[model samples]
Each structure stands twice: as structure tokens, then as C-alpha cells.
Target: MLLGEELRLIAYNTAIKHNITTSMVHKGLYQLGVSGCPWKDADIVEALGDLGDYGVHNLFAVERIARISEVHPYSRVKGLLYHSYESLGVKERDENGEFIAPKLLWKENFFNRNERGEGNAP
Candidate 1:
């Protein structure tokens, strides 16, 4: 078994390379476990969950997300973040800076808004 520090390093690299966090990696692991992924394939499963332009972030709607994989390819993940955030009872940040997606309908639009500072662009 890998030490916590070693696993942390792996997670750190994953975060840096994928723009996600170690905790998110854990989410993937959680999904894999809940899905009955084999113990020997845990590492692969974790990496798969963390591998993507958007990677994983503990969200998905109309389907199982974390603690469960969404089987990507846009059509599966598209427009899901909004509902994911919604399911958590947020329309965007709630005065403290949580749930920053801003209720957009599509994932690309959300990312576009995010790139433009969510209309803070000037």
C-alpha cells in the first residue's frame, strides 16, 4: 500500500495536471468502489476519473456522479453541472463563494462565462 504522502504526491500531480484536487481523485475512487470496481484496478479507475479536460469535481445530474462515474463524451456530461449544483441547493455562489457555475444550461457556456470572469469581464 502507498503511504499517505506518496498518494498525496500522486494526487498533487493529478491536480496540477488536470486542474482538479486530490479530494476529487478520492471522489473517483469512491465512485469506482461504489460501482464495484476491482481492488487491483483501483489505481486505473482513479486516474480515469481524474483524466479529462474538465476532469471530475464531485458533480453530475440525471445520473450518478461521484461515488459513480458518468460515462463521459459530452452528451453524458453536457448541461449536467448546473443541475448538479442545483441539486445541492445553489444557483451560483451563495454569498461565500461556493457553487460558482451561475445556473448556465450548458457546460461549455459555463466554462466560457468562467473564462470571462462570469460577466466581471470589462
Candidate 2:
């Protein structure tokens, strides 16, 4: 299989100009949440800045799962975690009221199902 970069090169391009550039679209598709390359939260913030009112819960989920997968023996975590956004200290927005992403914590507690369980760590 081609890597994210490779797939990106072959992806269809409308060549529209904006912060939501073709590159961002490609990255969103192939590299956003996986063991492809280093993707920063700032980039997500930039590409999705216009989507301020939009809830970014799904994107963070992929990011955290990928981070955990990178450390663990598998690429897909098979278990559930109990950590909440509050417990992980993840605020889903920046001070400017723009949408910020919650990153993954590399804690065993992130993967274990606690009595107060809610959802994934990110």
C-alpha cells in the first residue's frame, strides 16, 4: 500500500486556494490520524479554523487512537478507556474560542475501563 504522502500525490485536486488547501484535504484523508507522519495540532486548528462552531470530537478520537497505536504493539486499540476530557485535562477549544484538539495521553489509565468510565482518552 502507498504511504500517506504517496496517496496524497495521487489524490484528486480541485486546486482551490484557501486555508483549506488541497494539501490539508490530503492530509485529512491520509495522515490525520495514523502512523504516517508527524501532524501537529496547530495545523488542524489552521485548516479547521473556519469551523469554529463545529464540534471536533471525531478528529481528536482518531488522533488519540493513533498516538496510542504508535506505542502499543497494535495499530488499532482493541479495548476501551474510561478517561474523560476533564480527567485528561483536554479542553476542545482554544482561548480565542477557536476549536483546539485534545491530544492523547500515554497512560495505562487511558486504556483501562474504570468504574467511572465514559469514553476514549482523547
Candidate 3:
């Protein structure tokens, strides 16, 4: 809450130094498009770029479920994190084999029986 303009300016300059743009930044205070799968094709750095575009500090702060759920309407914090990284704005690919808003990087939970159409009630 204390992110002064100086820090914002530093962040902006860092973004520019790293080649991030303005329109690409998302004001996630509104939590729009905060749903979907974390990308599976890019590395952590690329994923951080995408998160940066969303106005996240890239400090990798893993908030509690209650806190994150306040921002994202998801059941699990992990799910919300996945969705957050997956919702970045994408643009046409540049000539460096890197996507403007690169995809996320994570593993799929194929063994989660809950999502496999199973129930506990008899």
C-alpha cells in the first residue's frame, strides 16, 4: 500500500530496461480475467514477465488462501496462483522466439481424483 511513485518509477524503468511495456501492465486490483490454467510452455523468467504485466511485484509472495481468495474466487490458493499467471495479456510474438506475454510454467495435477468425476456420498 505504500508503493510511492518513486518505486513505481523504478518499477517502470526496470520494466523498460527489461523491455516490458505500459499497456501490457494489468491493474489486477479488479481481478479481471483471473481464471484459467497456468501456462505450460515457458520458463519461470517468462512467467515472471507475464506476472509483471499484471502489476504483480514478481517477488513471489505466496499469500494465504483466505487472502488470495479475496482477490481471486478460487477454491485453492494454488488454483488461484495458476489462474493469475495464466491471465496475462498476450501480443504478437517478436523475432526472439519469446512471446510478449509468455505462457506460464507448471505441472498438471492429473492424480487429483476430485476432478475426475468422483463423489464421496453413497
Candidate topping TM-score: 1
At residue 51, what lDDT does model 3 achieve?
A: 47
Candidate numbers, best TM-score first, in rank order: 1, 2, 3
List the lowest-lDDT window of 10 residues for candidate 1.
61-70
lDDT of model 2 at position 61: 38
Clashing pairs in 1: 31-67, 31-68
TM-score of each: 0.36, 0.24, 0.23
Among the numbered candidates, top lDDT falls to 1
Comparing 2 with 3 on lDDT, the higher-scoring candidate is 2
**Reference-based TM-score, model 2:** 0.24
lDDT of 3 at 78: 30
Q: Report the C-alpha displacement of residue 33, candidate 3, in angstroms.
A: 13
Query: Which one wins by lDDT: 1 or 3?
Result: 1
Tens digits of per-residue lDDT for model 2 on 1-122? 45555544433232232324454444443444333434343333233322222333334434653443343322222322224434444454568988654344333544463334844543
Kindly report which residue stretches of model 3 are placed more than 4 angstroms away from their true locations once superposed: 26-122
1-122 per-residue lDDT for model 3 (tens digits): 22446435544554575444433322221112122222221222233344454444422321211133333333233323434333522223457966444222222332243357542211
Checking candidate 3 for backbone clashes, the offending pairs are 39-104
